[model samples]
Target: MKATKITAIDFFDDLSSPYARKRFFVGFIVFGGLCIVAMYLDHQFVPNGAIKAVLDSVLANLLSSILVILGFYILYTFFIGPNDGLKEVVPTRARDISEAMKQLPEKTRSYLFWGRSGSYFRSSPLIVLDGYARRSKIMTNVDVLMPDPFDERLINSYRDIKDSLGEESDGNPLLANVLATTICCAVLNANNRYLSVRVFYSAFLPAFRVDLSDNGSILTQDDKSKGALFFKPSSEFHELLRTSILNEMAVSREINLEEATFKKKKLDSGSCTPEILARFGVAEAARSALAPKIATLIEERRHRYT
Candidate 1:
């Protein structure tokens, strides 16, 4: 079957809804409150002599504490809070582009993974984003890390290109979404590949770095006499890889097959229906004849941003 095509309209359609806007405001308020409370507690409990002296000179400690808390509440609520809002608001356009890019085809996605090698486990965020972008038909550009002169110029040029394509002065929102999606895609693909390889090889592989050539190339060493070295995959091995991919896709998309399976099994159960089984693939079934584990590998990374 052909893959689904996602469009820019699909990406941005639900974002501007009243419900979404309310949720965004609620999130900002909660974050700002937490920041204010933490700042107040730190300033109050830290016991600074200078602060004590100032309090003694101006007012009592009780009043001082109250004043500090009120001051910080206002400061954070007004200045810092709105800055955070801008960060969210400005990134909406970029985010839409990133989402649109996710619908790209797999062959195009694989190009992002090509220039890197080293036990396959150390594949970076950029590579994964490229792969997903190619696979999903998403347009993505890597933020290259290099020394000062090259780094600044390259990144600036990249932003300029993105802005030109996007028809916006600042590509901040789109860039933010691209970076976020890149990280998400990288983590998801690497985890899937790592689990698949580990199951296939029955061994753990250490992550390692790979150096890429200036022209974005990597050399693969081949031992010709060892015919079918990489080409030889048993039917069982192919099944395993396919199953792993399906399960990874399900988990990434937050689809709970087990619940669906359970409801279906109650209705009619010789084994899982072909459609359900096909959606998850065999590895999921093999993991448990009854239920598949539902959890987010990507959600764990939310702490990094929050």
Candidate 2:
């Protein structure tokens, strides 16, 4: 015979059902104890006279109020179900990424991310990969799709979207951030045999960012004020998003992380010449200014991972 494990959820589930005799008895006992306390207080605090009668009446009223409140709570919890008064005016799939991740299965082994730049990946989605790598024994594959730096039209689209959102950058930081991310992925994939990271540069720019896993997907945008949207496997758009991202990644230019030359000096230099960036899969059109600042951003935070 197998042993059964008892959990608080089991008790709560029982309490919510119609045959909640144990919970009802517990409530009754609590009510009785409060009545005893009320009676004792009424006797001790008042003299034996009309004043005592008034005291008894006051205590009775207090006890009655408590009983009514308790009864209503029990009835509401057991019969009426949880109230949605605190719910959001306009509901979202999940509150944030952490909450969304919790809904995914532990066995998920693939992740596909499509976005304009590496900033979002560097900030948030990288942590998910690390976390999954720590516990999973099976091989995990990740595919990242972003616009090709050399494609002026796609790059301009990226800049226009950022400018519209008041995040005006000539795409230098984005390119540097992508390089730093590529370096980090190189090191991560090398160290962990089970993790495979593939980064692709495409000639297209997506309107929104989509992160797809085996069981669910998360949609986000550059503007942080507009929160993320989550989709379950059953959602019609979930499969559509997955197919679109996969299709884009298939034809995009993939960077050879292991073969790519990652020179600390070149990245940290004040200016990145066209030749230097082209060697490491960055577009020739990418601006050279802010290489030192980007190097500092990578070294101070993401360098440790590398």
Candidate 3:
């Protein structure tokens, strides 16, 4: 025979139930003991009959008020405790990226896009690729600045993640996909819908949520993120990104992902010229480093012959 564990919940249910006569009688006995103690203290504290009578009345009122308040609290807790969860909200201060993803609207016009950097390097654009492919969203015509397929920083980052999290990320589908392909990955909810947009910058992703709506809000992972001011996408920034991507698509030769290869002869500094990227507010150092990487990827594409 298996031994049954007696839980506080089971004990509490018996004691609190109306039909528990023995328990209720014992509770009254305890209450009587408490009353005796209170009365003894009161008599000792106020020996004068006239003053003691007045003090006793005041104390009785105070006790009655406290008891009433406590009774109300107990009643409310018993009646509303279970179902009150539905009405409770996760305040913005308490919200994290994971929680924000959970509340995302299934079909939305925009993604809450953000990705951290390698201190100064541009974050990966694989997040965009993953979102576009997984969502199969024709309506969401958003612009994304992508890294070269074989960008040194990007490739290195991918290798680092794969080596570090190959087996560890197995259970987490999102993490697994991200590890599988360093370039692009998306996470799906229990319903298999796309979760909010954000990219992995380092090996570990922090829990933070930002809603990139017309009027957006941010919930960061920690005090550091909290202190950092979130950026609002400007029209100029949006247009610049769109133009950059379109320009890249226009100039690049068609090649499938698997078939793509770097062309040493075609690789030129002009492919990711700083002059072009500078106009779009890309930092001088970032643009200089990023240009070559971007150009190399573009030049390397194996153009299909008609």
Candidate 4:
């Protein structure tokens, strides 16, 4: 088996779209008929002098209007072109996005999570979450979120990158999916270090920054809105992160085992799933499992900071 080549066209091609070529043929035929009718009318009506005068006047006015509009458009583009590039101004926060993450409840805040674009997550993260996970033992606070490689959503999400990976590993029984395998390798590498790791079928929301703590913050910027301020997390921002994480965790759990479970690991069982999800960081259901544990950790941090 081989990976299907990904091109711009492959991703754009609607896998289930109804055949539409026949509609194009119908359009061309209609256009031909209209052209014939126009030619026939031209031959049937010989413009008398009055009609010709009226037609000339209409054409003249139309041409003059078009030229004026075109000239105005040209002048607008010429003057506006240079400054147009600078029109979009990104907000300059007093701190970077990671600084906002630091304001989250300390214990739950250390875990680095990924969602949506794995490629983008590759770009930004906190210093502690980045390197500390490797150096420290599985301290109670360290956790990480990742996609379950065997889950269908995992491959389908990054299916666009298979072409760049050189071959589809999914085609063979022995070969695993390329991107999945890479992530799996990373998980194994971290697991060996005693880093707490959880894998899911998909993400609840797109990740802007990696702090997964219920108390953490997410910064949002609109391309259309210029000079927006980036501030530390407010209570509302904390709620937003908490809710989104809980939703994704709940949905991932709600997916039927048969549909969502990639490999039948120990956590797949009914009794074990909730315990594992809680340890891994699902809120509502997992609250019983880890909330007090996290709260205690936060208190410990406050004491240390003092």
User: How many residue pairs clash in all the candidates, one count each?
Assistant: 15, 0, 3, 1
Report the C-alpha lDDT of model 1 over 53-85, residue by residue, as the tens digit.
664444444445555755665566466443221
TM-score of 3: 0.26
Task: Give one digit per residue, the lDDT tens place, for model 4 in 39-58.
Answer: 45544684658765665565
lDDT of 3 by residue, 1-306 (tens): 111211123333433333353455566556655656676788888687887788677666656665665576467557754231221122232213333332332344453333222110112222333345367743432222223332345545544543554422222223212222221212111112333322322332323323333322333432232322222233333344334334544543322222122112122334245664453334676656655555543434321110
TM-score of every prediction relative to native: 0.18, 0.60, 0.26, 0.32
Model 3 clash pairs are 97-208, 97-209, 263-300
Off by over 4 Å in 4: 1-109, 112-114, 122-130, 134-194, 203-215, 220-234, 253-306
Ranking by TM-score: 2, 4, 3, 1
Q: Which regions of candidate 3 deviate over 4 angstroms?
A: 1-95, 102-107, 116-138, 142-149, 154-211, 215-306
**What value of lDDT does candidate 3 attain over all alpha carbons?**
0.36
Model 2: per-residue Cα lDDT at residue 172: 45
Error of 4 at 16 (Å): 50
TM-score of 2: 0.60
Candidates in order have lDDT scores of: 0.31, 0.61, 0.36, 0.36
User: lDDT at 240 for candidate 4?
Assistant: 55
